[model samples]
Target: MQTGKIGVTTENIFPVIKKFLYSDHEIFLRELVSNAVDASQKLKTLAITGDFRGEQGDLAVRIKIDEKEGTLTISDNGIGMDAEEIDKYINQIAFSGVSDFMEKYQDKAEAIIGHFGLGFYSAFMVAKKVDIITKSYKEGAKAVKWSCDGSPEFTLEETEKESRGSDIVLHIDDDCKEFLQKSKIEELLNKYCKFMAVPVILGKKQEWKDGKMQDTDEDNVINSVAPLWSKSPSEIKDEDYKSFYRTLFPMNDEPLFWIHLNVDYPFNLTGILYFPRVKNNIELQRNKIQLYCNQVFVTDQVEGIVPEFLTLLHGVIDSPDIPLNVSRSYLQSDANVKKISSYITKKVADRLNGIFKDNRKDYEEKWEDLKLFVNYGMLSENDFYDRAKDFSLFTDVDGRHFTFEEYKTLIKDNQTDKDGQLVYLYATDKEEQFSYIEAAKAKGYSVLLTDGQLDVPAVSMLEQKFEKSRFVRVDSDTIDRIIAKDNAPELDLNETQRDILSEAFQSQVPKLDKSEFMVDVQAMGVDAQPVIITQNEYMRRMKEMSRYQQGMAFYGQMPDTYTLVLNSDHALVKKILSEGEASTKETLKPILSEIKGLQARQTILQQEQGKKKPEEITQEEKDDLSNTEQNLSKQREEKKQVIAGYAKDNGTIHQLIDLALLQNGMLKGASLNEFIKRSVNLIK
Candidate 1:
């Protein structure tokens, strides 16, 4: 036996390895297993290059747990290290054997994973002591044993061994005894080694024997030596891709489509990205894309590696060019990662475009599931938007689908306003906004169904992308105003009539929470509804954007402002105006006459004051002018009270206002019940 201190600059390297080597101690299993696989791969390369004439038998890496002994052993049938190699590789903490092997066999070695030699030290994270028994494949080579107890001091000795390989035995620490559990080891192997280059055996296959579960003699391999992404796309069938997807995510529904990424030049990359069925909540769909480096699993949280929008996709992305630290736990940003992101964005757009151009009907069938992803990419990535706009679809309320350009052409003739700005009318809810959608259709204008999770931001982006264009929700205003092609007709009403109508409707508007209504009388045709509720487009968009944007919280807190438009051409509005004048004209005449006299006196006093300088105006003249204004205000208040009284007793006014509220889906609780009762009475 030979004892020596590990050649390290720092004396406390073991403690750092045990405590701070990895973010998660569970990563120790991945590091050890990956090293074993690398050893196996090195041996294969040596044999292929005629360096080793020995027969290469089964190179499966095996993991075993001995709960009774409190030890976990990872054994491999690969090239093992003699005493000199162990002392050179193991004693020197940062010198990697794989790095030296790659330097010699760089052209022939397959998937050499170890870059930093620190992977072996990760074993100290969970093990109080570790032992390695290895024998070189060289003829007449002696087997060796190396032992370290979580310290720089280690023992190396010649030991008897049966075959050429390495057995890493870890005596788990007291606080880390969970690593001794069979289930825990199996879980780690499945997560980090499920797609490894070499076979990984966890335990024996289990079967029901004599009505009880028992381990069979067959080895239970946990990893696939050849995954779908590692293969050529032309050789794979559709079902094979789907089967791989099921292997990746068993509980998820079948993917809508997949993009096979196999780029070699500039930087090495290979993987399959599947377009998963995204639901209404975009957050739930994130972090599904698993990232790997040369078949070794890295992480699923690939936020920085992929673009923010591409995280919605699911499946695997394996790239040796992706930089990782020693632990291989997280990603490190570099030019390659950025290139990979741009490449993926382009691939996704190209896949979508191909699908749309080849089989548009099938693409349309999947649009409902694909909209959230496409819209997210369009809104977040400018380059992606430039590629995606040609294939991205706009589905209408009538269930017809059109590409962005196609929809623009379909509506360009009629939806353009008098100012030559193209208006894209959209409805959030097909049923809730059915009346507005129908009204838009009646005007021969197409209304898109922009109701996806990211549609609000996507529509905002489209407004900037399309020149001289704007997107307006169909229910945001009256159809004629939303896509006005001609000037609005003038209302034939005097100032008194306009004031009475405005006051009556405004008073009857319900006091809804977080809602404010402004009354406006418009000369819509007689076929229009008596009253329609319309939200302000800019304010409504700001509020919707606040749900996704961080700095727009102020807009979300403000009350929703809506316009309660009374159509003067409608018969109900006309009857209300005529009847109101007839019923209140007699009583309002004397009040109006008094108001007119006060206003005339107020105007004459204002004109007299305007003619004089501040020094020339007498205090009495100022007093008289102030008094006339007060009297005029009082007379107007009395007139408003009389009009409000008439409106309060008028069921038509209440019915019209309630109908507008119900149409907006805002009538709820007792108000909805009252609206229902009032509607029935009005019908009777």
Candidate 2:
């Protein structure tokens, strides 16, 4: 027997492997199991090429545990090594056995997956002493044994062995006793090797035949030798895809559809992507797409592989081009990764367009669930938006769906404003904004139910994409303002009359927390509601967007401002004005006469001094003009004070304001209680 240190420039390789090689030490099992699968695959290749004139035999990689001996062994019945082979592949520290083997037989070994030449060394992370015993497939070969004990020193000698493949034995360290547990090993195997190409056996299969689980004669195979993604698309059925989806996500809802990605020319990528039921929340459904490298599981954080919106999808993406150990910085800079992202975006768009063109009625039926994903993609990726423009759908409150161009054609003549801008009216909440929706529909206009969480941001983007188009929330303003065909007929009241009625109605407006209202009088035809509450669409949308974006937090903190529009043409408003004026008319007649006398004097003085220069005006004339203006202002205030006082006690003014507040979903708590009580009293 002869022993010497590993062929390395530094003695620190073992220490680095133990403490710093991988972020999680549990990955050691994955590396060992993958190496075993690679070895078995190589033997199969040699058999197919007639290089070996013997049976391929059972290729299942077996894992065994000896708790009393404190050792775990992974054995494979594949290509083994002789003494010279061990010295060249195992004794040399940095050289990879699989790398040179692939170089020799590149065409026959495509599934072999070993990179960086460091996977075998990772066993040092959890083992104190590791052993390798193997015998070559050649006609006359002797089995060899190699052993190392957590250091550069190793020993190689001839050993008697009956098998033809390799056996790797690991002596568990005291610090990593948790790995010895059966359940822990099973979990790691399920997560990383669930889809491996070769059969992986852990122990004897168990059955609960006699009220308790007992080991049977059969081996417990733990992996799927042929996953759906590795098969041809022509061999897969819709039910097969759905079954695979169910396997990946056991608790998730059934997927709406799936896209099978199979490409070889541009950096081989093959996988299945499913369009899950992604609605209501975008953040909750991310990180569900598991990324793999040559069938070995890598990670679930695939934001770099697919676009941000496509991360909302679910299923597997296997590509040999992706480096096994991925870094965020590398993913951002890798050329192959960028091409994969672009390709995924195009595939998603093409699939959606195909579905839309093939069966539009079916697509429309599923739009309620599909809109969120499509809208998010269109709002984020520029290329996706360019492709999705033709197929993206719009469903109105009437439950009829239309494409962007189709909707434009449907409402172009009636919904266009005087400035030739097409008005796309939408409502965020059908129940809360029902009156607003009905009001629009009453005017022969259509309203879209833009109630999705991402709909607000998407509408902001559509404003720039659609030609001469703007999306307005149905409840943001009155129908006249949303799609104004002509300037509304002006209110027929004078300035003082307008202010008096405005103040009267404004005084009855409830004080809601985080809300402020400004009163405006408009002549909105006799059939319109007496009082309507409308928020500015621009400010409202800005505040909504600030909920998702970072730099616009100031808009979220600002109080919601609404316009309290009082219709002058309505009888309730006209009656309030006339009655308030009538009740105060007797008291204001003499005040008004004195104000008129002062105004007449001021007009006479102004005419007399019309041609005079500033210095020519006497002090008495200036004092008289000033006193007349002051007295007139005082009299109008006294008159308005009386009228506003009467308006406060009037039930009609309070009722109108409360009804408007209730319609806008702003009336609640004590304010709502008070309105209810007041409403009851007025009916009594």
Candidate 3:
């Protein structure tokens, strides 16, 4: 027997590990169980290599809880360390100082176990005292028992035999009795060791007999030694991939498609990535991709390994190249990590392209489900954008789909504007913008459905990617204005008459909060709607961007500005103009005649003065010019008042204004009620 203090430069190392090693205390189970699996695998390797002459049998790890004895034991038939081996690996924890050790591994607590030879010490965190009983597999090896309290001192001696390998017995502290509960150990094993490459047995399998669960002779193995991700892609069938996905996420809908990743040369990476139905609530499904080291589970928060956009996918990514317990910042800065991200991006794009080229009908059927993820990748990753554009599609309102190149070629002949730029028309809400879409279709123009959550940002990105192309919403303008092939005819109304008609309808428009309108009269064909409401593309796009991103709050805060266009050629607009002209003509005629005479006199006086030098100009001439200008200003005011008087009580003007508002989904609440009542009265 022997007793000695642990060999450490600092007085002891246990306190340092307990304080700075694990921020999450529950990871202790993962560390201890993982160490046992590693030991078991090592023994198997030694037997295969002829280093150990003894038989290699039953490498299964077992976890047992003795609730009455208040202890938990993890036993494994693996390589067990003699006293000298234990002293080299465990006793000598070479610590310079707490600050130095912490500074070295501050942000990397997860990496400490395998990298720093501290896997066994993690048990001390939850156990008041721990005992290691073992007989090494090496020839002439004597069985030994090692015991320690939570301190620097320990006892190592030859003791009663165990078959071989080691047993780690933990006398759990009062605060950590949760580890002794069979259910608790089972849960931790399920989480961290579910995919480990060795059989981990927790307890006996249970059967429901006599209305209760009882143990059977069969062992309850808690892990899959060779999970689906570790297998070759050719060995996995589609249903097998789906079965694995269902196990990973049982409550989720079956994935639309999956990409099997298997790369070996520059960096070892293997996994399966599933493209789930992400059309709705993209933010809800993010971070479902898991990252693993070899077969050991590392983290589901894999934003550092997988690109931010691909985090929407679900499945496992195993790579021994990436450190299992590194900081996110460290992971992101790794060269291997960058290569892994680029490879994944290329792989996903290739898979999508293959599916599209092979069975376009099936691909189109799944486009609605795949849209959010594809758009996100294109918008976030540049290389992904370059590849995705080949297979990405545009679905028209008629439910027919076309590739970007195909659609651009189809529309370039007629839809290109006078500035040599092609115009792509789209609709967000097919139901609300139904009339606008139909109007566009009437003119032989196709409107696409860009209604997904990411479509707003995607539209802005596509415009930059496609050559000399722009995307416009169907309801953003009149059909002719949205994709202008030729100049629209000008209205024949005079300036004063135009003002009179505009004022009449503008005054009757409902007063909505955070809304503004500017009225314009256009000579559209008589068949067009009498009044149409349209929003400017620039402001609307900016507001849409503000909803998902930062730095555009100013645009979001501004009122929605709409262009209220009144068609002068329509019979209803023509009637309103005629009625307004008749009612205000008599009052405005005398004031207009006076203003015309005064303006002619002022023009003559200014011309005569221009012919003379500043000092030579007569004082009487200056007075004449000043009086003419004042009279002209006063006359314009009187003319405006007469137009206002006729506009205040025009019923036709109010009805036309409401019709445009209702079509655009802008009319609501008390104003919508008023519009309904007035519409009923007009019908009567």
The root-mean-square deviation over C-alpha atoms between each candidate and the true structure, in angstroms, is 1.8, 3.9, 5.0
Q: lDDT tens digits, residues 1-684, model 1?
A: 999998999989977876665888888899999999998998999999999999899898999999999999999989999999998899999899988988999899999898989999899888989999999998999999999998889999999999999999999999998898888888899999999999999889999999998999999999999999999999999999999999989999999989999999888999999998886767888889999989999999998778998898999999989988777887887988888888888888888999999999999999999888888888888888889888888988889998888888888888899999999999888999888888888888888888788888899988998999999998888887777766767789898898889888887888889889999888888887889999989999999999989999999999999999999999999999998888889889999999999999999999999999999999999999999999999999999888898899898998888888887788889988987888787689
TM-score of 3: 0.91
Off by over 4 Å in 3: 94-113, 326-332, 591-641
Q: How do all the candidates rank in terms of TM-score, highest first?
A: 1, 2, 3
* Candidate order, lDDT descending: 1, 2, 3
390 Cα displacement, candidate 2 (Å): 1.0
Name the better of 1 and 3 by TM-score.
1
- Model 3's alpha-carbon lDDT is 0.82
TM per candidate: 0.96, 0.92, 0.91
The residue-by-residue lDDT of candidate 2 on 1-684, one tens digit each, is 769888888889887765666667887888888888888888888887788888878887888888888888889988888988888877786588887878888888758866656788888889999999899888799998999997889999999999798899999999998888878888888998898888999998899988999999999898998999999999999999999999999999999888999998688899989988877777889989988777777778887789998898999998878754521112334889889999989888899999999999889877878888899898888888899989998889978888888899999999999999999999888899988898899999999988887888999999999899999998777788778877667779986578778878777787788889899998888998889999999999999999989999999999999999988999989988898777877776787788778779878878887879999999998898888888888977876676678887888888888899888777889888989999888789
Q: In model 3, state the lDDT of residue 420.
A: 91
Task: Kindly report which residue stretches of model 1 are placed more than 4 angstroms away from their true locations once superposed.
Answer: 601-625, 679-684
lDDT per residue (tens digit) for residues 1-684 in model 3: 989987766755677777776655667777677777767766765665666778778678899999999898988887787877766666766322222423644543221224446667878889999999888788888888888897889888998776888899999988999998889899989888898877899889999999999999999999998899889988889999999999999999999989999998799899999999878777789878877776777678887678888899999998867754321112435888888888888899899999999999999999998988889999998888889998999988889899999998888888888789899999998999998898888888889998888888999999998888899998787878777666756679898778877877776677789999988888778888899898899999998899988899988999999989889999999998899999988888898789889888888888999999999987887888888898888987777677767877777787888888888778889888988998899899
